[model samples]
Target: MPERLTILVVDDDQDFLGDFEVIGRDFFELHTADSGEKALEMLKEEEPDAVVLDLRLGSGIDGLETLKRIRETWPDLPVIMVTEHADVDTAVKAMKQGAFHYMSKHPNIKTLHAIIQKELGSVRWKNLCLEEIRKQYGEMIGRSAPMKEIYRLIARVATVPLNVLVLGESGTGKELVAREIHARSGRAGHPFVAINCAAIPPALFESEVFGHERGAFTHAVSRKTGKIEMADKGTLFLDEINSLDPDLQAKLLRVLDDKAITRVGGNEVKRVDVRVICASNQDLEKSVAEGSFREDLFHRVNGIQIVVPPLRERAEDIPELTRYFSRRIQMKTGRAGPVFSGEAIEALQTYHWPGNVRELMNVVERASVMAAGREVTVQDLKLASRSGKSQGFFQELLFLPYKEARQKLFSRFKSVYLSELIQRNQGNISKAARQAGISRPGLYRMMENTDE
Candidate 1:
């Protein structure tokens, strides 16, 4: 059976809260709090699917202030604000504050119930769609918030024929994202060509991307088709696109604008229908600002931009990723896969992965081959010590109680790990926060608490 959705209702009126017992019993599990203060406390304990907050609390903070705090922590949680006396000004304020819906409390409880049901149903459908994407795209893994948002964006842009720019650190599977988009797009039947812009030599770069006529240049014995032509009616993914030569960037821009390409040493302009997807590890905006990249070409390819979070940001998916890698190794060797101990998994999660998913796969494969037994212990996974302090840092937590250990681990990790992260980004909090997959304000708060 499916699990029941939980709803947290905050109201000062005990009589009004009691009405939910009869109305929501069949549809959801309901939890009630009398005032805004109690509601905030309940949020820490109960992971509610939706919140029904009263606009005017009899005591404590008002609903708007409570909603503001809730948005800071749980930005995606659905909130429905209901007031006894609804006004246009109040409703506008609630909506602007990120409330899912604003409504006046009517005598009939069914209206509110219907709204909650509809919202929950939409959430469930979205989750199911994400799960389907996960099952279909084997190469693209992770169900973390960042990955889920990427999946949603992929689904939204798959049908639309627009150039896309994928930005992420190396080994974050930018190519996999491009492939998934092509596989789900309208041009699935056609070719999906890929070229690493950084790998090709400067001399051969133009010939590789745009085909050459016979005897056009050295080693051009016969007329050749370029990546764009090969991917006609399909997708052309340019990996490490920031490395493209300035001259080629202009040529590429012209092809995108005209939907045609001219072969080297040939006057014929070939018309091709190809969707372009560009991936870059470096900041193309900075390159454009420094005059190293063309601003016009950047705009041409950046119709839609998608940023893939690094592995450290989605550490919750580490264990599953480890399992998947272990299974692949087992298939190749025809042996049983290794089972990771809880401590080993936790150790993996604590490490700051600079190389992202590719690095994790390498670590898992190495550990699987080196493990003495079927169960992989923490020692089997020889994780590199970051700054020579991680070994002692994690060892210190082993003696504490589970709750205390968790708190201490998080606190220390925020101080040490986040500090190093910010430093690595050269004190740019926005860049560090993006790599860490948290809001800038959230990072500031964590850093401030660490200082305290």
Candidate 2:
């Protein structure tokens, strides 16, 4: 497929927009805005490869003001200015304000295309250099292949502090990933505020995030700082971000774009400087497609995507993780550290950790209390080794290593389960994922690997 590079044309001329749409249809995807204010809004959504702007706008904000905001927010963006014969001087002013090039109202379409191509070429090289600088492993623990890949991605995206959308299963330490990024960043000294979006009540969500003035409400007797305000000069980690109230989703996006927030029941807009990193167990793209999540807000937060693989894929790290968590827990509790037997470690590795690292930590802590003589044996490590109800599989599981038997029996079970599920939902992966309480991508992976 030809690359669908987007080009945004900002002008009040309906005829001109229609002309470009027809002209650029073959080579690119075209988006249009009638006013400067709308253009900026569209820019956030469309994220065009390049912009064709009119020097003189109709109303709200003129081209100059729009250009200024774009330059401030997305400085490297290339914007070509178009003007009428009477507005040539204004076009020159637009150039001085960081316009890529200025042209007549009826500029040659070929020249405009060439300018867009040139800008795209420059943007690619700029992003390439940025990617090279962003590749470094932080304090994340894990030497597994999958984990090394995650570290690579973390380093790749850490250079410029772009808004990130972290995706992982529950108990996969999403917050730790956020903290690692912040710790390696320039804002390490600043507060790293985090809130589970699902934990906040819907009625108090707004006040909790944006604060409330003293006596602003019936219960508000004291002034309090909001998460956005507290996270200024730092990072805000929103866990289970898909659970944010629909009403607050739009409000959050506006704050992110404006870099300012007005407290609930207050009129003053306080400027904030915070990098937002959000995590979701749910598939946000599916949520957006289902209309439960705002598509615009999704795009705003997904500047960089990092998907943390589930522990089952990185079982090689279990023993190391076990030892690390053990030492840390021992230091905190001053208890005798339990020695994990080779059998115990193999038991942990063999089990499919549905709850991932967090679950493993809980098991290790429990084993510390349950162990006899500071030695964690196979009996002490009561790991869950069952996948699904396959006749004779549980008895057979006891005899064979989990990984060896997983292919033949579990594949059958998963294939039957997913086949029934997909059929029940009429082949809708999103609905099947929700019904099975797993991520859509995970469900798809199972279906791809299964043979039933």
Candidate 3:
């Protein structure tokens, strides 16, 4: 069997610690520490993903003292504190210290399981990505310019363990970038936890991030572990990080600085070791300046910034991207794919795609689905209207002499008038006349003269 994550359970009660061991033995290699001194000794060799510590550990150097030392030596360790009934004040104080979470006596086993899994899962993900890359790619993909730049940056700073900020538009594959960095870094095979800040609601953000003890508050049906604890000794990818609230931002900064986190509703300082990689569509700098985000947090996260260029900025990659999409679409749809006509390619090249590669992929996928013949036509391209005019808006003018620009404009208006009339009447002319703000005879005369 694979080597499981090491977990330390520290409590004065040997019976309670033994129970925890039985519950977690299947998933982790359990270690028990009865006192603060013992816990510190265990920590030196086994940097655990989680530490279950009791608030009252006999008499000398209590759980709180052990937590402080843990935070001092390994600030990024995830710790969970156990408390007695009505120990809310102490719990709150433990939270202020850096406990990832806290739970009361007779805590829910299911909640404990969930918290352990969340943290353990993050570790598994980081390991899988790095191990897969080393075993398959030998090195990360480097043919693409954006990829090469990222590789260079990772190689330079992977050993230092500073925060990395990855900026890109949605669908630009920022998560992949984060993975590549972790794979190349010294912490490869450790946890790689990813969470999208914008995807989670603000109301549940705290519980989603720092976790909550069972019955921490209303609807706190079970205990939950946030991504931070899951990513101990690994990398944490904070996608759409700009959406984090200002208050949460401050809390996150505190964690980054002290390497600790306090779970919601429970108090105990948990130490965690994590490298944060934050990605955002928004300009965090501007947000910081406007007081919508924390500047200190921004600096901490933005230690090394990598901006992923939009697909349009790298126009040279269109053919490659298009071809790749085409092949994938063909495989998925099992369609006899239409070849892009020369004119169709030219039209695509001229287009100023506002939606970037994601849009391009959609266009190709749709075209593949709608192909009726062996070739995709200019008409099939369905380019956005030029200046909001309907189909043939530019084509009609393109054929006209250069000097007839004004005359072409007039022709366009006449076409618009007829189209509008048809639409207003539901394809009936008599009703369209009144709706056109014109007389029936006048409308007929206009239609006759403008007939294509």
lDDT of 2 at 353: 75
- Per-model TM values vs. the true structure: 0.58, 0.56, 0.53
Pairing residues by index, what is the TM-score of model 3? 0.53
Write model 2 residue lDDT over 1-452, tens digit each, in one string. 44556778899989988887886677668888899878866664546788888877888888888887777545578888877754656767787888888878787766677777788788789867545533443335677888878777766676676999999998787777888788778888999998767656677788889999998889898987898899999999988889887888988889999999898888999999999999999999999999999999999999999999888889888876887677778888886666676567878888777767877886788787778754678787655433343345577657887787776666666755675566445566776777577888998888787763
Q: For residues 1-452, what per-residue lDDT tens digits would candidate 1 score against the true structure?
A: 23456889888988888876776576668899988878866775555988989999998899998887677445567899988999999899999998989977643455666776687788788779767866767578888999889989999998998899999998798999999999999999999998877656666777878889999987889999898899999999998889888988888889999999988989999999999999999999999999999999999999999999999899988877887798899899897655666567888898887767877887788788889975577788767533244566578678889999899767756765775566445577876776577888998988888841
Tell me the deviation in Å of residue 258 in model 1.
1.8
Task: Report the candidate with higher lDDT, 1 versus 2.
Answer: 1
Identify the superior model by TM-score, candidate 2 or candidate 3.
2
TM-score for predicted model 1 compared with the true structure = 0.58
TM-score winner between candidates 1 and 3 = 1
Q: Which ranking of candidates, highest TM-score first?
A: 1, 2, 3
The list of candidate 1 runs beyond 4 A from truth reads: 1-131, 385-452
Q: How should the candidates be ordered by lDDT, best one leading?
A: 1, 2, 3
Residue lDDT tens for model 3, 345-375: 5566667665555567767777766767756
Instruction: Using lDDT, give the best candidate's number.
Output: 1
